[model samples]
Target chain A: MSEAGVSTLEIRDLRVAVEGKEILSGVDLTVPKGEVHALMGPNGAGKTSLGYAVMGHPKYQVTGGDIIWAGQSVLGKPPEERSRLGLFLSLQYPTAIPGVTTTNFLRAALKGQGKELPAREFLKLIRSEVAALKMDQSFMSRYINDNFSGGEKKRMEIVQMAILKPEMAILDETDSGLDVDALRTVADGVNRVRGDGMGILIITHYQRILDYITPDRVHVMAAGRIIASGGSEVVAQIEESGYDPMLRQAGIEAEAAASAAV
Target chain B: MSELISLRPMTRDDAPLAELPGGDPDFLHKLRTAAAAAYRESPWPSSSRDEDWRRTPQIDKLDPASFAAPGSSATELPEYLARVLEGPLAAIGASHTVVTDQAGNVPTAGGSPRGLAVPLEEGLRQDPERWSALLGTIAHPGLRKFVALNTARLTGGALVRVKRGQTAESPVRLVHGVDQRSAAFPRTAVLVEEGASLTLVEEWVSPEGDDSLLAPVVEVQLERGAHLTHVVHQRCGSRTVVQSTVRVKLARDAHYDLRWALLGGAWQKTYFDVEMLGEGSESRASGLCIGRSQQHFDVQTLQDHIAGGAISDLLYRVAVAERSRSIFAGLIRVEEGAQKTNAYVQNRNLLLSPQAKADSNPTLEILANDVRCTHGSTAGRIDDDQLFYCESRGVNREQARRLVVEGFFADVVDAFPQGAVREAARSWVLEALDELALSGALAAGYGSA
Candidate 1:
């Protein structure tokens, strides 16, 4: 793959497997600095698995390719190490850590990133973020994702993303369970953190979020591979024709190439 | 009161008894009789190959022969308990009361309207029949050997009683202060009449120079429609040894809330046994313990659901540092025919140092199929993610860890009764954290990246 522009993340022929089953076979993606890319796919298309594999989740094994972040191979690094390297993942279902308050959890994450802000500064940052997200001030004292509503939890993920200020972020299905108002609010939070130095890969099954935060590039993933890649029109096509036409095109192209090789 | 009985002389064999003053006629007689009986009947718990005592060799380490009763005139009690009693008394429009010098002395000042606090020996002499009857009714003879020993040889303790339908707006603080170089057995019996509400704070402390052993027993009974909040703060000196047992019974529609703070003591073992004996009774028991240096603390709890439709929830958390060790063993038992009972027991521990160890065993035995009962025990080091999350925000490793540990124990601490008692516990926990930081137990830049 050619390294053009400020490519913060480069996924080359990335293949991942879970429980002896291959997913994301030979998938290639790149998120250059100051750019937003949306990976849109149908249900069970391994869009979430790609985010997990890139973030170095232990369960998602990279069976074939390499994930390069900031010109360095990050395949062997653990999640915390990758986080230190300025990588963040907005999980669709954030794990609830009982007895850990949201403020305390965010503070730890910030400290781990080697940006240990002073208490006053940290509280200021969190208060501003919470207000920007329209979260109740009392939410700071609540346990991390414990007994939180779906929208509240999603907003918390955005709050974490903003506070951590990661160089690259992989948001996996962040818009799945949100209402229109909540979706807009979350998108606004995401947009506030978007800029020239940050790259965001928004993985979604619906095109609602794309309307709020437009993507420069959209890729359609099917059957563990990126079958089609194009500009923002690809999302509109997927929204219109659904995955059947693209599945047919991918199958035809694979069969033709196989027969020609034979 | 009976005449004081003097022992033969102060010998190494009779050292334990010599710790108590040779005065107080009634207390002396009770001590000699109980000590003689304990020496003759109950042999020292065998440390040889006994399964329960094998790892914790009870007899090998303790020289029971040399253990003695504590003295009468020792240093003043810790200021925390003092402030607790003084603040509430003034809040509820009570006059300044004279603080007692010894645990047995009753404070002589403005009279408390709702409850009565009397020394155990005084209560026994003033009304032996009533005191003996109440003691016999509550103290079971077979199960707890320590309670039996305490009952037989008990000296000075508090007898707090709340009259029927009377609700004391202020909490009654019972400060049991032990003297230097003495072993004190303080027995407290609390009785709440029907429709009465009372809050009792039992603060156990040893004098500064005291290396005494405090073996106290507290028995509480709540009548129908009664409400009681019991807070036990065990803040003895580092050289002090304390083994306390609290047994509570709740009647119909009675509620009991207990918050224990185990912040001090060289070796402390507390057994909290609660029984929901009447239908619709509720009990909440939560505690926070901090063990450092060579301290070893163990808390054994049992929530027995003997009646139907009773609810009980318990949460206990401990933070261990240095060579300290903590063990929490909790059991939730729902008896047969006790239907619709809800009970949950959870214990979480944070191990700050590699050498610091924590053992938790939470068990549930449900005989009634309709009952909902669950118990869980978790022991883990501080989460790397949590630590990193704190550090990345500019909190040094120490402060970040302190916050995580504070959060870990906040679940229990927050449940403490709202007042000075809660504040005292909170400050004590923070002090322990500061000590942990000063000792360099928290490593620098420890969170992974």
Candidate 2:
């Protein structure tokens, strides 16, 4: 976790869609490595599309524009290729695989990165990570997210991010449905793995998660584009006035600048 | 093919009764002779034509005459076959072991015939009276072609008897080694005396080649208050075609637990029938099948409750990948007046290849309203969200899919006969995954069929 490093993720004029319906239009964003950027927007502002488009999800088609990770473009790669290239996405909704365990999934990810660990050392790491997440040891042996509660799924995503040790992780609404206690615990998990040489882009609809992990930068998206970005003052203004005023001041829906560009 | 072993599609002229070994009473020979004549009477089952076989509708075009059912001399097993047999034994060390390699062949170092375990033929020769009584009423020859064939050309069978008020020191392990390109008809008869208990682990192996055809018929009788746990593990090569039928009769207060681990084969068809004959009887059946490539499996089962106060539960999980396919059809039948009967059946199938296909058909026939019965069947692909969750963690799509598929099967495999059996199952699954990975199937196989 390099707090002050040079690795960067620059998204210039990223346009994305799903089944020919455009979602993200001309979205400009940049998260230099070693920094936490809070991405806040209203319900239908295409906030999730950016996270998925950057992760190279097949469903989130990138109709135009570039996603620069480190120094090269990765717009055409598969999700696995993007993952191996140090990009990660923590889905708000994780799929349940009936019999696959977290331990095996983690091992598979490590192998994908050309890394293998001794069983003893691997167990030791798993034990420590499980404890850090306040999860039972049995959780590692249980099937991945199979019938898991909302909080358990959140903790699972955090544990995976911590273990996979990605350089940049696009957390798509990681705090969506969690209570305050679980939210704090998951926030602490993010903070623990925060400064380990990776850039953090926290996408959310509420300001609660911001209370724990203070963002170095805050970007507001509306209708599909990043209409405003600034320091923590932007978050304070949004909280004080709500997203309506911000969208109104930016004239996001009048001319529909985001859609017209697409 | 030998004259005694390779009698292709039975003609009335084929005289199997005179070829089989043993000096049983004339009635025994008469039964075999009648069975052979019945084999000639029954027509071959066509998947596309027969009502009972219509659900699966998929099978290998195997020639019955080309395969042989040669018997061994009851001596030491060959190294290759022994190597396959020893893995399971070492994993689940046996209290008594028996093999059908040859005459005087001691499958185990010190298996006692006087007590619990004995060779099939020796047990038949030693107590010709009891073995005949049980085999006399097992599978009927005229009911189906495969049954008739197995009855007409039976070889290399075993009998494990747990006497009353006695429990085995360890599981009685039975291992069968079939030669490549030959057909073998094997049978197992398990008789648990009243209040007796035994666990039998029977394994079938054919070395890695498309060189054998295996057809087996098993009969289990659980007397009043008797208990038995039978685990059948079949892991033959994909080249071999295997079809097995198991029939069981549970008496009053008797409990029978049967589990099948169908891990390998090019073509596999299996059937299981359990009849609860008296009150307070119970049975639990479970199985898991993991297949890839061009493998095909046709699985069916029937739970017939003839008396009151009997309970039966069964679940089977199947995973098919590549161009493979699986068909599962199960039924729970509660006879009229058989009230107070509780039963449940479920079949789950997973598809991982675009070309892979699966069909799950679960049915119920309840003539008694006082009975409680339910059946469920589902065929689905790997969850997209789960696959994404895995891939998002830096695992490639292929490995992620494989992990999810293995997880799908672990639910059924992990809970049974926990120690060595579970470990062997996991190891077998990994071996299969390795084969799939090396063939470039992990990435190239998934598609919507």
Candidate 3:
């Protein structure tokens, strides 16, 4: 890879462990400004762990290696600091805060980043975003993710992404629980916010979401490490032959691999 | 039930019971005389020994005799009290309101139930027999030490009554305030005659920086087919201490809905006794408490199903910060032969600081063979996952904690009437959390826990 620049996030042989068990073992990757990288793997390839580690989740301990963002080390920063530094992580299963309304949560998030909008302006912006996402207006009043459908949750994540306008976002299986229509709407929301040199890493198990938002680079992970890296050919190869051929090529059996780590 | 003889005869040196105002009816005098005897017979509750006072360490230090006698009516309302009246109280549109301060009372005449709803003293003088029979019928002086003291020193309170077959459009407000280094014992009696309905809001407030003791007792009687909505809002100064009890009885097919908000006091111990006396009676009780600074709160509630086919539901929530402590103990008792009874009790506590402590205990005593009863309690800190979720969205830990705390109390407050009452409660919760944040308690939330 080219020399890491100020507008790039470099994972230098990144290693992460959860509950004293290593999940990501010596994985290296880089995504430059304005580029969308697709990180795909089979059922348990530690794809989500990479997103969490990069965002500084307390449970996802960085046992070794370094994560450099914007030409500075972010290993010591808390998750909020990481977010303030223009990083976002779309959780696969968003937590439901029972009584916190969606609009209030978004407003607090904006204020945390020193971008607080006036009440009327904020409501106007949220209304436009909700309309664009084909979401119901009542979503703003409902508790965040409480009793929401799986598709609605995925769309809600995208709505936050659109509002937050982060520099770098890691979408962890955002397309896992969406139908065709919701997937398109979610993909459109992500694409609309993919401006201002915002880099994205979309993690997925299926190639369907990639059909809408093309990836600059596709990387396959196996046994807690990236086994292969290429362009659209990687997506086609995995879609046609599945991950068995790639797992065999990397000299690792598919089922025996201990990648089922959260 | 302990046999403890009085070392001295009842006098002003021991308490203010003997100094009660004269010209009272024989029943009123005899009631106070009997309560004084009971007060002398019982000793102050010991924190270590008394099961009910186990979690309350402040109870052991209480000395009611050290404080001044019960307050006289106030001639002028303080600025703080006036502000409250012009704000939340005025918006409530109470049909009858009587505001009491340390000096005296200022009663406002409303649309209906004019003479029927008056001060407790006036009510007693108007109908001595009726007032005598209703007073202390539910919250008997023998119930506890404080109850006896309250009865002996009872001076000024509101007596709100709705005649049979009448429905009051607005609430009846009994607003009481106390001064620094003083004591207040306000007794309220709310009577809803058969097929009548009424709404009552009792607010007890103390000015900031005051160190006082306020003990209030409330008795509620809902006759058959009657409906009553009762709201008790207690907001005291940070240095004040409080001991309060509310007793409610429901007749056949009667309904009692309650919202009890305890938001202040340096140390507070409160009791709620809801007895479903008649068959087909129903009760819904919701309570919320926000504790900060060095505040201590111990709230106890009982849902008694005395008759068959009654229903009772109770939910209480508490949030504590700084070095505050909150304790909740609730019991649902179903008597034998009260078949087909349904009861539910739940208590949830949220600790916003490592130094903040909360303990919740929910128990059930069902002697009935065919009854459905459930009880559960939970005490916990903010969920790490939830905090992380908010943090990942650029919200700091402190702000995230405020949101979580607000969300924790929303369900209970959301059930309140959607107007001034609910808005006032919501603002108070926000203000309390802001205070906690200012004290740097929110910074110590995720550390070491």
Model 2: chain B TM-score vs. truth? 0.91
Task: Please give the distance, in angstroms, between residue B394's alpha carbon in candidate 2 and its true position after superposition.
Answer: 1.1
Q: Which candidate ranks first by lDDT, i.e. highest?
A: 3
TM-score of B chain for each model? 0.85, 0.91, 0.93
lDDT, candidate 3, B124-157, per-residue tens = 7777777788888888888877888888777767
lDDT, each prediction: 0.74, 0.78, 0.84
**For residues B115-173, could you state the per-residue lDDT of candidate 1 as single tens digits?**
26565555555566555556635544334546555554455666677789998777776
> Could you give me the TM-score of model 1 versus the true structure?
0.75
Task: Looking only at chain A, give the TM-score of model 3 against the true structure.
Answer: 0.96
Candidate ranking under TM-score, highest first, comes to 3, 2, 1
What fraction of native interface contacts does model 2 preserve? 0.82
- Runs of candidate 2 with Cα error greater than 4 angstroms are A1-6, A254-262, B1-15, B18-20, B55-63, B69-76, B101-112, B445-449
Question: Sorted on lDDT, highest at the top, how do the candidates line up?
Answer: 3, 2, 1
